[model samples]
Target: MTHFRNDMENHDFFDTNIVCSIVIYEWANELSIIDFKHIFDWISQLVGTAPDSIQLAESEAKYKSYKWKYFEKNNVINRREWDLIAYHWFRNIETKSGIRVYCVASTRSFRRLGIYIDEAAVVDVIGVMKQISRTIIEKVEPIYGYGAMQSYLDGPLEYARGINVTTYYSHENIFSQADVDTRERISAFGSEFRKNKRRLNEKLRDVEVINYISAGHLAGIVDGMTLEDWIISGNRGTLNKEGEATWVWRIPDEHERSQIRTDLIRSGLLVVTI
Candidate 1:
């Protein structure tokens, strides 16, 4: 009853959870492992423009595999169909049609889509389809959790939001069990770490720096600082506003860049990058 349903009206779709429910489950073993390659093939066959977009998405999440088959089965409308249905559910036929750009394009060329991001849309038509009433086909997995994105702090968490979305994938504030583990580990280490530095200090003997860096290697040295101070700063000091653990401290010119790096090695703060 998903894509084939009749209250069809201007006929299109809807959704609340992310397309693939991969990130919702806290445990890796809970999901059915499926190859993204098959999804890519299906998308490619259907639209001819998904190769680039899919490849980009895949590369972005290289740390873990991208699974699509389970999502296909859940919606009964194929992933592409689901996207159209979900967007339709979110916006009306008139409103969705007026839009020129979307994260997921419908066609492979501009001729088939409205305009904006430059690349041909691969999902334009699918998103605007109006001929089918939507249904879940089957029940979504009973064990599901919500992942909140923002400002939900004042209210109940996502899981308590009372929406039909039993699972959330890409949003923030959704803490999976793995997240809990990492948080617990950090918590366990917190008290000891806050007790004040015992051996790590301003003394010059402990820090290390390096030279001959690769492009964007984020390793460099500052002037007049002992290696120990460098280590202290890098390990437990002001790491800019973003908390980027790796960085190259500012040096004025190429010569200064070279000199400070050498000085750091001489000062002896451990210098290793890889």
Candidate 2:
């Protein structure tokens, strides 16, 4: 067997998800918890049998355990280190062509989670693989309710156009109409008010200044705008439009480009030539 000492020293760590995907793709037939344990145990045994490999694995494992324990105590593990170790382990296995062993274990659940391997560790790997385990879960859980709020808005918007024609459309006059005509007028006015409010909000929302710079000018503008927005506005050079060179703004009608230019000039980020 290829030795762990030689392999570990040379490998570059990769993301756990990639390793899991590779294993699943390659060993869809016989992957299991038991199989995973067998492979790890076999590797561990090789470490034991080879003095150099054993020393390396022990040294690496000691350092890893110390780092893990430190992070665990201080809560830094959730922020960064765990993923790094899993990444290292995954890279070490795949770099040495040991992916077939993981592939075999991925097919068998029992073998995959068996004794020599901790199911919690595999759970950790699964969590890392999905990019949605402890670290993400902790960060996302607090914001989970926002998703429901979004769904509530999105659900209405999905059928908003057809809502008036639907039977479920609740009009005040439809239920109680002692003064049918007056109620109809009031309801129409209320609907108009709501529609106008929505439109006004949308218009207000649409008004935002967008700035752009070419790749060559990126370093100068990085602090002023997002990388994504910069990329969306393609690279272009400013030409001397008249006696002076001018940068053009390309925002849709809602935004006032002159105001943006004034602000940029006032901030001294942009210079206007006479």
Candidate 3:
């Protein structure tokens, strides 16, 4: 399979592929506790209500709801330092014409922000938030001192994703086109990535393929064996053994098995082979 390969010269074969992406960020703006308080107060004042009191009003023809709350839990802001949050709210605005702007404060970086355009919206939420955050930061940046504004997809490391916006600093999708067979194999592997590892002692006399999921867990068979030997042997067979497993991954050869195993091991998503 494409994911598994043999290096002829090295006479080696490895299974699977794991990909990781990370971005780091530095301080862009600064804000003190008092400044954050003021910002929250300003936003609440603009809407003519207290943070918790913000909600849709029947009087306004347009649908609207603005809410916020403060928490003193341990959190990483700006630089990996723990600090309390002053203002936080997930906001969605839609015009009568169907234009929408969705925005949320960066939970990672207390002072950072994020905006993603809704699929149906005509206007870019990023463009709108950029202008609004710029003004807010301009007024608060010098006063409060916070990290720079970095845009990131919805996930962890939004702060790291914010470190810089240049192509070099931004997240890049490295996925490439795979042939039909390769695509199918990858699809199968990904779908079952969280399944427990299957036991095929026949392929690995001493070692047993294992499952991995999130953060850690990937050592390839109980005992380390030469890639060549592992390839020559395999773990696939006719459906003979059965119990609670809903399904099993019918590995073709140890070479391909090792590749898939390697990929799963690297990404930390191997489930018991099933």
Q: lDDT of candidate 1 vs native?
A: 0.24
lDDT by residue for model 1 over 1-274, one digit each (tens)? Answer: 1221223333322222212111111111222212223322333343332221111122212322122344344543333311111111112345433111122211111101111111122233333221100100011121111111111211112112111222334234463232443233333323322343211111111111211111122223444543335535545222221112212122334454345445554543322110
RMSD of each: 21.9, 24.8, 21.1
Better of 1 and 2 by lDDT: 2
Worst-scoring 10-residue span by lDDT in model 2: 142-151
Candidate achieving the largest lDDT: 3
Task: Kindly report which residue stretches of model 1 are placed more than 4 angstroms away from their true locations once superposed.
Answer: 1-248, 270-274
lDDT of 2: 0.24
Predicted candidate 3 versus true structure: per-residue lDDT over 155-212, tens digit per residue: 2122212121122221244333334543344344334322422222112111122110
Model 2: CA > 4 A from native: 6-30, 46-274
Clash count per candidate:
21, 19, 27
TM-score of each: 0.18, 0.16, 0.24
| Model 3 lDDT, residue 120, Cα | 23
- Candidate order by TM-score, decreasing, is 3, 1, 2
